[model samples]
Target: MITKYLAILRMKYVEMFAYQLSTMVWMFGTMVQPLITMMVWMNIYPDQGESFVLYFVALIMVERLTSAWDVWEMDRQIREGTFSYQIVRPFHPIHWAIAENIVYKGLFLVVLVPCWIILALFIPSLRLHLSVTGWGLFLAALLLGAVIRFAMSFLFGILCFWMNKVTAIYAMFETVSLFLSGQIAPFSLLPPVVKQISTFFPYRYMIGFPLEILTGTANSHTLMIGFIGSFIWAVVLIVIISLLWNAGLKKNQAVGG
Candidate 1:
C-alpha cells in the first residue's frame, strides 16, 4: 500500500514540473509579500529592537514560504462535482494532495534559500540565528504544520458540499489568520485577546508557534507545547475529515463507474 502511494506521489511531482511558466512565476515573485510587509513594518518599528527585525524578517519569509490555501482546489473539485472520481479511486484523496504539497514546496525551497541569503544581505535590520538544533526543530514543526493546514483545507473544501458560498467563510478565516499567525507581526505584539485566542486557533499553531520556536522566542517548553498542540490538531482534523468524507461519499451526486 505504501509503495503504491509512493509511486503516485512521485508522478504528482512530474506533472507539476511539466508546467514551466507557472513554476517560474511561483518562484520569482512569491517572496514579494514578505518584502512589502517588511518595508511597511520596518517603517513602523525602525528602532524598536534588532530582535524584532530578526524575527520579523524571518516571519515574512516563513509566512510566505509556508503559505498554501488548498481549500480553493478542494472547493473546485467538489463544485465541479468531480469529487466522486476520487471516491471511487483505490487511494485516499489526501494522498494526492500530500504529494502535490511536497512537490511544490520542495521545488521552491531550492530557490528560496538562496533568495533568503540575498534578502538577509540587503536588509541590515534582518537577522536570523540559524543553528543546527533550531533548524531541526523548525523542520519538524513545519512538517506538522503542513499536515494540520492540509487537513483544515480539506475540511473547508468539504464544507462546500453542505453550504453555499462557503468560500466567503474561508476568506474571512484567512484574514484572521494573517494577523494572528504572526504573518504580519510577532504574536507577541498582538493584543492580549489576539494572543490568547490565537493559541486556540489552528493558524497560530500552523505558523506563529513554529516561527517563535525557530527564532528562539517560545523557548523549549513552549515550543514543545506548540508542537504537541499542532500534532493533536492534525490528528483531530484528519479524523473529522474521515467522518465527513464518509458521509459525503454516500451523498455523492456525480457519476462514476
Candidate 2:
C-alpha cells in the first residue's frame, strides 16, 4: 500500500511538472489575495508590532498548505462518470485525492519559500518569533488543520452523488469560512462574540490556531484548548467522511449502476 501511494505521488509530480507554467501562474494568483490584504492592513496599522506582519505571513502559508482543490476534481469525475472506474479499483479513491493534494502543495511550497525569503529581506517586520517547543506545536497544529480541511472538502464533494449544486453549496461554505477561518482578518482582531464563537467552530482551528501559534500570540492555555478542539474536530470529520462515502457509494450504485 505504501509503495502504491508513493507511485501515485511520483505520477502526480510528473503531471505537475508538465504544466509547470500554469502551476506557477496559479501560485501567483493564490499569493495575490494575501499580499493585498497584508499591504492594506500594514498601511492602516503601520505602528502594529512585528507580530502583525508575521501573523499574515503565517496565514498565507497555512492557506496554501491546507488548500483542497480535490473537491473540484472529485466533482468533475462524478459529473463525467470517471469516478466509476475509481470505485472498482483495488485502492480507495481518497488516496488519489491525497496524492494530488500533497503534490500540489509541495510544488507551491517550492515556489513560496524563495518568494517569501525575498519578501522578508525587503520587509524586516515579517520575522517570526517562536521557541523550539512552539515550532513543534505549530507544525502539529498545521498537520491537523490540513487533514481536517481536506476531509471537510472531500465530504462536501461526495455530495455530488445526491445533488447537482455542490459547487453552489461549496461557495456558500467558502463565504462563511473566509471570515471564520481568519482569512479576512486575524481571529484575535475579530469582535469579542465572534472570537469566542470562532473557538467552537472548526474554522479557526483550520487556519487561525496555527497562525496564532506561529506568531507567538497563543499562550499555553489557548494552545491546549486549540489542540484539543482540533483533535475532536478531526476525529468527527473523519467519521463523517467515512459514513458519507459509504452512503454516497450506495446512492451512486442505485442511480447509475
lDDT of 1 by residue, 1-257 (tens): 77977798789878976896877786556557655776676678777656665775566556645666678876777778777687678888877777787777777677667776787788765546768888888888877777777788778887777766878898998888878788777766778888888777789888887788777887767787788889889889989998998787666666332
> How much lDDT does candidate 2 score?
0.84
> Once model 1 is optimally superposed onto the true structure by TM-score, how far is the C-alpha of residue 151 displaced, in angstroms?
0.9
Which 10-residue span in candidate 2 carries the lowest summed lDDT?
248-257
What tens digits encode model 2's per-residue C-alpha lDDT throughout 51-111?
5677777788888888877678778788888889889988899998899899998877887
Instruction: Give model 2 RMSD, 1 decimal.
Output: 1.9
lDDT, candidates in the order shown = 0.75, 0.84
| Residue 218 lDDT in candidate 1 | 75
In angstroms, how far off is 26's CA in candidate 2? 1.7
What TM-score number comes out for model 1? 0.87
Kindly report which residue stretches of model 1 are placed more than 4 angstroms away from their true locations once superposed.
Answer: 26-30, 48-53, 120-127, 255-257
